[model samples]
Target: MVRRIGLTGGIGSGKSTVAGLLVAQGAVLVDTDAIARSIAQAGGIAMPALEAAFGRSVIAADGGLDRAAMRQIVFADADAKRRLESVLHPLIGTETQRQAAAAGEDAVVVFDVPLLVESGRWRAIVDRVLVVDATEATQRKRVVARSGWTPEAVDAVIAQQAPRRLRRAAADAVIFNESMTLAELETEVRGLWKQWAAATTR
Candidate 1:
């Protein structure tokens, strides 16, 4: 049987970096965010529903989602966010499950979910939850430097996510990423990868 692990963290927590390392070491990564993006792309499965819900304004000239416009609207209106999720979640969920199922019986599959704790749906499916954690200050600084997002904007996103303490409490394993070098982070991930591999084989 494949051991399914839920890998999650807040923005700038280096979750994607950890996921990359695991993939290099043979873990099958089911990235929900990527799936969501694909499903909202030009002529994607979710585009028709999004068009019906928000109209053509939210769809770009290329027929893909106008993500920036939609982001602005959704952030300003809670109802809009819910509406968008309703359109995309079922499709994303179905694709994620299909990808996991295709990873083969002996693989170690990692579901990289940005909102694992907030969603409250992944815990039942994953054998373990690995949170890549960093300090709030670190997260803010990293986001500002990498994305050029205003500090206030970053804070608003953090506010919308589950608190750090709550994520820690929910984690079955955690990688503290603050102040860690890339090499150190890779080493930590490698250790965890070994553990999961052993568990799956047993």
Candidate 2:
């Protein structure tokens, strides 16, 4: 059977980097972020529901989700965030499951879930959770430098995420990415992938 892995990390924790390494090592990747983009794009599966729930204010001129407008609303309003997630979560879940079901039985299927720790519904589906860890200062610095987000914006995002300790507690294994070089991180993930891929393929 497939080994379903739930991978998570705070913004700028290098979680996507780790997922890329796993994919490079032959793991089948199902990225929730990518799926969300597809589903929120023009004519996507989630468009109608999203438009119905949030109205035209959240829709861009191109008929896709107006992410900036939605972000502005959700960041200020908790209820809006919940309502948005309610519309997108089920559809994201359905598509996530469909992709996993389509993978080869022996595949090491890695679900790259940015919000896995916050979602509270992934434990039943994943065989293990891999958390990518880094200090808050490091996270904030990295995110601000990379995404051009203000310190306040980064702080806002981190505030909404599961705290570092909470994420670490939920982890079956944790990768501390604070000081690693790209090559070193890649080596580490490749080693894990060899072991995990071997298990499922065997």
Candidate 3:
């Protein structure tokens, strides 16, 4: 049988990098964020509901979701966040499952969910949870370096996510990706992949 592994981490914890490493190990990846992005594009499945709920202001000139505008609205208002999640979550969930189902047995399927710890529903769906962890300082530094977001903005986002302890508690495996070189990270993931591949194929 295929093994479904849930992968998550705080923003700027190098989760996406780790996921890319895992993919190189002959694993199949089902990424929720990618699916959400797809559905938020022009003429995509989730655009109509988004436009209806938030109006034309949240739509880009190209007829896609104006991500910046939506982000501002949702972060400032809980109800707006909820409404946005209500529109996107089901679609993301459905596509997630569809992709997972299509990964054949003997494949190690990694479900890349950024909010796996907070979602409550993802734990039961995956056989294992792998958390990519980093210190809050590292998280803040990375986000600011890469995204050019203000320190205050990064702080707000980090504050909103699941605390590090809770994510550690939920993890079946954890990758502490703080201040590590890319080569070292890749080596760690490769070693872990051998173990998982053996476990699933055995």
Q: Pick the candidate with the highest TM-score.
A: 3
lDDT digits (tens) for residues 1-202 of candidate 1: 4389899999999999999998987889999999999999998999999999999899898999998899888889999999999999999999998998899778789999999999998899999999999998999999999999999888888888899999999998999999999999999988887876756755
* Model 1: lDDT of residue 98: 94
Model 2 backbone overlap count: 0
Model 3 residue runs over 4 Å out of place are 199-202
Total backbone collisions for each predicted model:
0, 0, 0
User: Best by lDDT, which number?
Assistant: 1
**Candidate 1 structure, TM-score to reference:** 0.95
User: TM-scores across all candidates?
Assistant: 0.95, 0.94, 0.95
Candidate 2 clashing pairs, residues 3+ apart or interchain: none
Candidate 1 wrong stretches, greater than 4 Å: 199-202
- Candidate 1, poorest ten consecutive residues by summed lDDT: 193-202
lDDT of 2 by residue, 1-202 (tens): 4388899999989999999888887789999999999999999999999999889999999999998789888999999999999999889989988998898677789999988988898888888899999998999999999989899988888988999999999988899999999999988887776665666665
Q: Which regions of candidate 2 fall more than 4 Å away from where they truly are?
A: none
2 or 3, which is superior by lDDT?
3
Ranking by lDDT: 1, 3, 2
Q: Cα miss at 192, model 1 (Å)?
A: 1.2
Model 2 Cα shift for residue 190 (angstroms): 2.1
Question: For each candidate, what is the lDDT?
Answer: 0.91, 0.89, 0.90
Point out the higher-scoring one by TM-score: 2 or 3: 3
